[model samples]
Target: MIRIVIVDDHPVVRDGLRGMFDGDDRFTVLGEAGDGREALAVTEAVTPDVILMDLRMPVLDGVSTIRELRSRGSSARVLVLTTYDTDSDVLPAIKAGATGYLLKDTPREDLFRAVLAAHRGESVLSPAVAGRLMGQLRSPAKEPLSHREIEVLTLIARGCTNRETAGRLFISEATVKTHLLHAYAKLGVRDRASAVATAIEQGLIRRD
Candidate 1:
């Protein structure tokens, strides 16, 4: 039997998943957690073969938890099971070391198959998620800058210092710097001037 740990913020969802797996002869429900932090603890203690993870939760989110798990050298394969299928949700989780991404609405049999595939160290993706990844591959555009990163670039183009940008955006100066750093990395520019210029050239922000 494959050992499994379910991670979801909702108790009902956790119970439902546990019941589903427990009813299956090929799988065993080893543990459950309400959020990512608790997931770390529970999975550490139980050492499950596969982890069913949710994307959104209090304390810590799924992607961060997956990264933490990988950093700690845990051998458990993570399989994301969440309601969200958007690019923002799917891309990060996959990049953070999820073995599979399945929508919550996946058929029971399909879910079981996905878990089996995950245990075998195979990649699994819901149809919608697979399409999104395909679209990303076909697109020639660079990684899109987030809205907040665009806001930071817009402020910088308007001659705002990091401190001034923080004041205008109602965020901390450190946060302003962090956004700038992210923007720089995404835009492939090393400094503020180049970031602003690239954002303008790409039409991500207004030159005026």
Candidate 2:
């Protein structure tokens, strides 16, 4: 079973998640924490297989907690479950070593899938969160993505919001996030600025 630990300031959120994962043959909710410092303490004590982290919390907050986890070389992958999927939220979590990111509103099934994927060593993002990440796969020489990811990239280059991109591309924001996460892995880039700069250098988008 996938051993999981949850870290969120809200007790209800933690309880709900625990109930969600309880007794699943594929996963086990080992423990949980209500703040950053506690998260560290519990994580060190139990060495959970994965952490379901909330970005906004009192005390250490999710970003700093993730940094500490990395600094200590904890192999536990973090899956950031937050209410905000904005650029501000998405960028820092990845920068701080979170393996996956999604809004708290994520459907329970997708949340479970994301956790499982992260445990398997895959980076996952909500589509609204992935557009900026996908922008970096701009390469002239490399084989371009099929029609969909390209649409996501173009909208990213144009600074369109994920909602706008979704509207334009006839897809959901989550779909956009998945595309960008795929692109991020392929391009070896993280976050918007690096992704965009790399794309420009690769001639995937016009410098003008």
Candidate 3:
């Protein structure tokens, strides 16, 4: 049997998932967590074969938790079972080491098959997710902002001035200004306000 741990903030969702998996002979529900922090604790204690993770939660989000799990050398494969399938949500989770991505709307049998595939170290993607990834590949790729540029914009969004941002980043104000200019050019915005707004809209930065 494939040992599993369910990680979702909603108790109702967790209970429903547990009920579904409990009846299956091929799988066993090891435990459940309401958020990513709890997920870490539960996974460590149970050492389950697969983790069913939700993206958005109260304490820590799924992608960050997955990264933490990898950093700690846990070999449990993570299968994303969330309602979101946007590029921002999907790309980061996959990059952070999720074995599969499945929307909450997936059929019960399909979800079971996905869990099995994930346990076997196979990459799984829902049809909509696959199509979105393909569409992104076929479209004209916009110049992505660099890490420094994003940092600068994120600080600016948080109401940091150039000097303040530079001080926080341990750089000169001129360097911060340069990063901002680059970010503006890449985002096709003319000013700081517009750049921040555009970045937030494009999911490049979190909205404060």
Candidate 4:
């Protein structure tokens, strides 16, 4: 049986996932966590083969958790199971070393298959997420913003000034300006406000 851990903020979601895994003969749920920080502790103790990680949570978010897991040299494969499939959500999770991305609405059998694939170290993505990735891959001319560019834009969208963004991101103001300029060019916008607007419109960043 494949060992697993479920991490999500909602108790209902956690219970549902735990029940699903419990009913499966091929899988065994080792633990569950209410949020990313708790997940880190639980996962360290149990050392599951696969982790079902939700993207948004209190204490720590999924992307940051994934990065921390990688940094700590955890061997568990992370399968992101969340409601979000936007570019901002998907790209960051994948970049932070998620093994798969599956929407919460995925059919039961498909989610099972995805978990198996993830345990085998295979890449799994829901159809919507896959399509988004393929579109980015095929759109060479349109050029998706780099991760740092997206980060700058996200902070800007949150109403942070250039100096504030730099301080928060631990980069120089000049570097922040440089990232914004590159983002403006890629987004076909000439200013911070327009770049933020375009990025939000394109789903490259969320307004909230």
Candidate 5:
């Protein structure tokens, strides 16, 4: 049996996933967590073969959790099951070490197959997510923004000035400007406004 852990902030979602997996003879629901922090604890205790992770949560988010899991040398395969399919969500999760990315709207049978594939260490991606990744990969001119670049752009999108962003990120103002310049070049934008717009358009940042 493939031991599994369900991690999501919603109780209904968690319960539903548990119910679905519990009836399957090939899988077992080892435990559940409401947030990424709890997920770390539960995963460590249970040592599950696979983890179904949700992106947004009250405490630590899914991408950060995945990175932490990898840094800690946990071999459990992470399969992201979230409502978000945007580049901001999908790319970071995959980069952080998710074995698969699937939208919450995915069919039950498909999700089951995805989990099985993930347990075998195969990469799994929903059709829509796969398409998005392909588009990104095909666009040679559109390079991915670095983590710091995204942070700077996110702050700028929120109307923060370079100095303010630097203070918030605890970096020097010059460093903030450097990140902005890098982001602008990667996004093929000439200025902050255009860069922010392009990043949002490309789903690199959430639009508020």
Candidate 6:
């Protein structure tokens, strides 16, 4: 079973998610928090395998909370559940280390699947977000990217094969593909095009 903490400012939302998870055999909601600071404290106290985080809590908000947790070396995989759909809101959460982004309206089963995937370090982003992010990465930057990621995205944008990005980056093709997946998750995009666009927008990589 996957142990999880649910953090949202709404008691109703928390109750609903708890009810849903309580009915599942593979997951159990272990704790609940209505604010970001409480979420952090509860998570640190219990150290669950996953956190279902709401975006707009009063004290810290979802993005900063995730960043704080990650900065403090907490390994709980964060899966964001919020009503926000804009790229600006979602992308910041992703960049702050959320493993997934989901609308509050997500079906219970699908939300469960996303949570499970996040426990395994996979991400969930809407297709439209994926597109806009890639489109945005086609700009200039200041943040540092791994040499390997640079090689991969540059090649990907140029239409290089995964095998080709791998060859040029001097890593296994599988490794190149894996890095792209992480990059995409971190960039809050889905494919190479969106990854490139969002990376540029987020300063994870460069542009002319």
Error of 5 at 66 (Å): 0.5
Predicted candidate 5 versus true structure: per-residue lDDT over 36-139, tens digit per residue? 99999999999999999999998899999999999999999999999988778898999999999999999999999999999999999999999989987897
lDDT string for model 2 (36-136, tens) is: 99999999999999999998899899999999999998999999999876555677789999999988888989988999999999999988778756754
Tell me the tens digit of each residue's lDDT in model 3 across 1-208: 9999999999999999999999999999999999999999999999999999999998999999999999999999999999988788898999999999999999999999999999999999999988988987898878999999999999999999999999999999999989988888887789999999888867899988
- What does the lDDT come to for candidate 1? 0.92
Give the residue spans of candidate 1 off by over 4 A.
143-149, 152-208
Task: Report clash pairs, candidate 4.
Answer: none
The global C-alpha lDDT for each of the candidates, from Candidate 1 onward, is 0.92, 0.84, 0.94, 0.93, 0.94, 0.84
Q: Residue 204 of model 1: what lDDT?
A: 78
* Residue 35 displacement (Å), model 4: 1.1
Give stretches of model 3 more than 4 Å off: 145-198
Please provide, for model 6 over 1-208, each residue's C-alpha lDDT reduced to its tens digit, 9 standing for 90 to 100.
Answer: 9999999999999999999998999998889999999998999899999999999889879999999999999999998889876656777898899998888888887888888899988877655566666766875543456777876887887778998877777789889888898787666678888898876655455565
The estimated TM-scores of all candidates read 0.72, 0.64, 0.76, 0.75, 0.76, 0.64
Q: 97, model 3: CA deviation in Å? A: 0.4
TM-score of the candidate numbered 1? 0.72
Clashes of each: 0, 4, 0, 0, 0, 9
Give the Cα error of residue 123 in candidate 3, in Å.
Answer: 0.5
lDDT of 2 at 66: 99
Query: How well does candidate 6 match the true structure in TM-score terms?
Result: 0.64
